[model samples]
Target: MKKKLAATAIGAAMVLSMGTGVLAGANLQEIKAYLNGSITVKYNGSPVQLQDEQGAVVLPITYDGNTYLPVRSIAKTLNVAVNYDGATNTVLLGEQAEGVALAKDFKNSSYHTKDPNLTTYGGKDYKEVYFDNAKSSRSSSFMLYPKGKYQKLVLQVAATGNDIESFYVQDSKKDIKLKTTTIAIQDGLKTIEVDIAGVEELFVHADIKEDGGMFVPLTTSYFK
Candidate 1:
């Protein structure tokens, strides 16, 4: 409805960042074409949700024991570059694309605990990185390697209003605050925000574990 399929042009290391909608709306006719499934499709070992132009989530179709996926959605998920020749009904999907993409890596603090069983959404397991509240520990470090100039980085953060205050993005000599909560990339969830305007390499740190008792989980965060 409101989101259309977009791609992150990254070289060598392929990173597929699909969370929420970035556009306002999609073509009405095209939207109806993709809403024809109820199964999740996994590309390169990660689950991907298909959506219509209206932002309503859709699914991959399974017919005759074979699963069919949205061509654009699948390509974006696996960092595969796709091109279509409408006249000949031909589609070309290529691995990776332009620009060097960044991967998410984490450094745990003393009190930032990680558990594989901590992340579950819509009855689906998301083996995301979960961090426990740190008391005597500092914020864990999040490393990002961006290729060129860019603006805005969206992240999925599960924390209350108070805890979010402890989060900040360290870009160059500036420590910028990530603001607000947005729609989750997963079907139904919420996330914290980040500002990555013109950032190359940066550090994402959340020192909220000092409050204790609470835990926060981070899902796949990407820059567009």
Candidate 2:
């Protein structure tokens, strides 16, 4: 992945008058409830929702007749990365990769066999998610949905003791397939990178040996 430059945002501001006298031990920060105000944010034509700890709007505060909204909250709703420099009292905002967070992955009913212990199927004790074809030539698939813009579906897959002959994303029309030089893991899943751009609905399908194929899972995320 290529790195992008980060943006910076300020949270709050304080100003004092020349005539004001300050005491060395006196505190200056104060908090008060604000009402009768409106604030809205949007991203990609979609409303960016912002909420407070109590699930209420993190309203803009009026201090010294100036209104301000929490910068961190606004950045988060837009999926922007944020970092704070306490020494310099700075807030750094950068490009953060928002991935396709899996809520639920639906699997097909046609699997050759099922095993809880992945070590039996392969060699690793890692958890097994889905298998394409281990006893038959049939194709098994899993349907998934991811939002926002992405270039491909990232998968960590391994088959038997050797790499599978064919593996592809079956939900889209484009010829998306796994391209990797790493051989199949004898015990764990290997990262398989493939192009799956412009795909909102994902169908990941794979075909391994009819007699000795049980794909194991490591981790799955989106890549752009």
Candidate 3:
């Protein structure tokens, strides 16, 4: 992914400030509550429905007893511009404003698949996997282990184009089949929670329907 020099610099500065008392620490629930009351979100100055008035937003469940707000909503509320690169599935949210408080409890961690060939499926390549677009492509299958029981299954799906469609837990030995789904190419990042029973080795497969091609990226720390 090409770096936006300006955004990169800003993000770097924010990261540094995280430890220097610039950013506060809090839990996911606390951050959600704060966001509920503190900011109103507008996409391109138009109100967007990412959360509710009572702060009862349906967020992706994570392992650490935290919740992830949609990146788009947070960026808009914080007055940062967001961009996504379809070819790479790379999302860039412009820098946060000075003195703006970010969710103190949420830790930014990288979770990715290692198989280079795993990106493309059904004659199409999704440059990166996102929590928002997980329901695309019925042929795609990914695994999520909860903090411990049985790992959950996040299959590439096609429910409603707007919602996170379907998610559930499954035994390791079960053979799972995914439904087909597709998403329009867009620039932005989406977060999702994968329930891993425990900290165990998890595998996700991105198999392109055409020619039965498969590419797998190395699994990193997935949330929930």
Candidate 4:
């Protein structure tokens, strides 16, 4: 998986900009140890240990001289909810249900879209695959060469008001199928790619019904 530090940091900044109060102070070493799996941090002032999916301590983070942790993970472990606002760069830690409301508020107030037709990959016109609620359902036809012939398959998506849950590409003759898991839509552009085996005609489907009201523009490209 890709390290989400840039996106996470942007979200954090938005939260702070919204006047969300920051924790006055925390021990850098303690936070570091906790994230590194060297130490377990228990909320409620308890002594229980927690671990990441791998049983390793999800190491604390230090970026540009500032210490940080996975806000969602830490909040959950501490029995709190985490909320982030990409537009304002702010975060809120509290109960889960309340966090949803906060997130909805941010979405409603910060939602905006710019023209996505200008995006491209490897000089290929990407707007050919773009779609929005206005067009609700559409199909994109493309060809994918064998893996050695192309370096990668790139998809650029920009959406607001809805999230892209899954995308699919299929080759009917060869029985090749590819699909993406749920991906959250942030305020700007997001790029996703996959490695291909060879050249083939592919039916590409990008699904974005999660929030129903949004539009998504998709561009497909092959890299050398």
Q: Rank the candidates by lDDT, best first.
A: 2, 1, 4, 3
Error (Å) of candidate 2 at residue 187 is 9.3
What C-alpha lDDT values do all the predictions have? 0.44, 0.47, 0.32, 0.40
Clashes per candidate, residues 3 or more apart or on different chains = 12, 1, 32, 24
List, residue by residue over 105-173, the lDDT tens digit for candidate 2.
434455422456532343444343555445655444566553223455567666763456555654444
- lDDT winner between 3 and 4, please give it: 4
Q: Distance (Å) between predicted and true CA of 93, model 4? A: 50
Taking all chains together, the TM-score of candidate 1 against the true structure is 0.37
Task: Please say which candidate is ahead in lDDT: 1 or 3.
Answer: 1
Q: Which of the predicted structures, 2 or 4, would earn the higher TM-score when compared with the native?
A: 2
Please list the residue runs of candidate 3 whose C-alpha ends up more than 4 Å from where it truly belongs after superposition.
Answer: 1-171, 176-184, 198-201, 207-221
Q: Across residues 1-224, which tens digit of lDDT does each residue of candidate 3 receive?
A: 32221210112111100222322432214422222222333344454455322345533223233333555435434434444433444454442122111121222223243233544444555554322123234444454432222233223322222322233323344443222223222311222233332223343433233222222212222221
- Per-model RMSD to reference: 17.9, 11.4, 17.6, 17.3
**Candidate 4 lDDT over residue span 1-224, tens digit each:** 32122222211221121222433232124232122333334355554443443456445544444445554455445433345544544454432122111111111112222334433323544343333444353322334433122323455545545665565666545677754545456634565565443323445555555344333332222332
Q: What is the TM-score of each candidate against the true structure?
A: 0.37, 0.41, 0.20, 0.33
Taking all chains together, the TM-score of candidate 4 against the true structure is: 0.33
Please report, as a residue range, the 10-residue window in candidate 3 with the lowest summed lDDT. Answer: 8-17
In terms of lDDT, model 3 sits at 0.32
